[model samples]
Target: MMQRLRILTSHAAVNLMAAACFSALAALAVWGPGWVWAFVPLGVGAQMLNEYNLHRFVFHLLPPRAQWAFDLLYRAHYGHHDFPTNEKLFFVPVWVAVPMLLFNFGALWAILAALGVADAVWIAVAIVPVGGVLAFLGYEWFHMTSHLPVRKTRVERYVTTLHNQHHFRDFTKWFHVSPGGAVIDRAMGTAIDRETLKTRQRSEFIRTLGLRPDDPRLVSARRRFATRYGLTEGEIARAAAH
Candidate 1:
């Protein structure tokens, strides 16, 4: 397991290049002949929102009714949830990444071209890709770091805790892998904290029974424990409603 903690694998490097290059372009966009840094935030914000949308709509989305869609989405995300520690699973294979890279670049370029801003097309092109790839690289790095056995930085500890919260405490919340992506989650109203409920009393019961949250055997645990603790079904319903 300690050996698996290594970073800078070929897979990570390949996935990282898009962002590394775009970040340089972003710096140039800021300090270059055009001085179009304002668009950087637009790019960043767009990427942030895009990350949130992907997490919520795709990763967290229920596998569709259609078999093919279900298999596709399940392979994309559900397996990650089931096997969170598999470093081998973390890599986006070159085969998949190449097509996605082309599509993302072409799509953003086409979108910017359609907007028809006089001097802004090139700026938009640079900004858009920089924003997205930057966010993605940050996400992959953050996520991988969160799974690392040794966490050191203040930011790492914070984001890793949130990532743990997403995996174990509550899967539906903390969907964003980037720590500050919580801002987008909050703005969009999906930020939830079950920590209070999990830690204060209910979690005590869960611990006492030694039941994992995902344990099928614990299917009635929350309801029964809530009842014993005098919480009404309505309260649980309301909590879930959020």
Candidate 2:
């Protein structure tokens, strides 16, 4: 458990979000106490929807034809699917997480203020920096645990099972990693019925996001990020052999 947490906190994105959540909660406690009860739940619910939509729509979008664009998506998500146990790829990258957090908070604040909410800024704080970020941290924790080789609690095991289905069975299903976010997946029609698909067939090209292991794009991406991501020659070769 300690090791898993160490790995979780190692990512810059995790640390930043952790700080944001704490800072926002502290600020809300001092200045916007009344708004906390209402807005925090709103933030959490909003982030749950955001988590499902981003995973289903954005991260799982068709591979880009452009090598550069493909590389970006590979770093953002494809590489995680290709190497499911790679700790480095477990959390959302800081470049992606930080910007999206800013955009969401800014947009919410603007919308509320324009609509004449007197406490728009603090309300956004309560919702985003506090509640939304807390849910994001939950996602990071569960996601990291899903990939780690550790004994898990009952709830953790359940989450890991569903997440494994997404990684190994069908990438298109089970987009929500955070607990309780599965309802969003069910509502959005992405949740697979385990009873209906008893055989649990693995998705084609499961490791490469439906691309051939040796496709030019995968080859280029692996080579391009090899040194940066510490992918040894053997790992690169093995990925291509899949």
Candidate 3:
């Protein structure tokens, strides 16, 4: 179908662009000033931070009502939440991600050039998106495998089940697809406790409160609610609390 071909072409273009960016960065790092390499980590960190913020603030909070905005957001985010295992929807559609990535990298490069760090900026502008693409690819593949009909290996099975648990039970904690694990989520106080997560699977009582799962305020709220209702500490400590 034309739709499938379009999707394939879009995915391919995004990936190719990412690869070209990486190659450019690599070439700059090898031939340019040694100091340029120092900016690599910062570039990676910026992209990661962007990913975190976009997921937290944009995708989760800013629901779209307008037709174009809704379709864009739906493809980039909402569709994933609606059907987490939909292989066709795993990677961010190229139409959405490519232009934004270029604009961001271009802007950052311009700023760095103004600061007399053009070489470093070039490297970063090249490498960061490439690294991001690799991360995106990993997320896409893992997400697809997670929902596949075929049985997974033990570790794969664990991660897939964990991701599914995040979709059906707790959406806050387990935000990272894989490899990244809970590093940023834990730092942001959005991580679900393992034991508490287990408890959430058995009880639907906690899901009634439409609390923002990533918000830290829910922690105190849970404690207060428990005290007010005379609920057991274990019950109050459920992952659904935050």
> Which candidate should be chosen as best, given lDDT against the real structure?
2
User: What TM-score fits each model?
Assistant: 0.67, 0.96, 0.65
TM-score of 3: 0.65
Pairs in steric clash, model 1: none
The ten-residue window of minimal lDDT in model 3 covers 202-211
Which candidate's TM-score is highest?
2
Clashing pairs in model 3?
none
Model 1, stretches more than 4 Å misplaced?
A: 1-8, 12-33, 65-67, 91-104, 194-242
lDDT of 2 by residue, 164-223 (tens): 888877788899998897888888888889684565575473788788889899999989
**lDDT for every model?**
0.58, 0.87, 0.58
> What would the TM-score be for candidate 1 when compared with the true structure?
0.67
Stretches of candidate 2 off by over 4 Å are 199-205
Instruction: Mark the 10 consecutive residues where model 1 has the least summed lDDT.
Output: 204-213
lDDT of 3 by residue, 1-242 (tens): 35433444456544665576667567776776765556555655555666667667776655444545554555566545543444555666666567767787787777777788656465654446655545554555566667666656776787687677666667655666555555777888877776787666533322322334433443444444444334456554544343
Q: Which pairs of residues collide in model 2? A: none
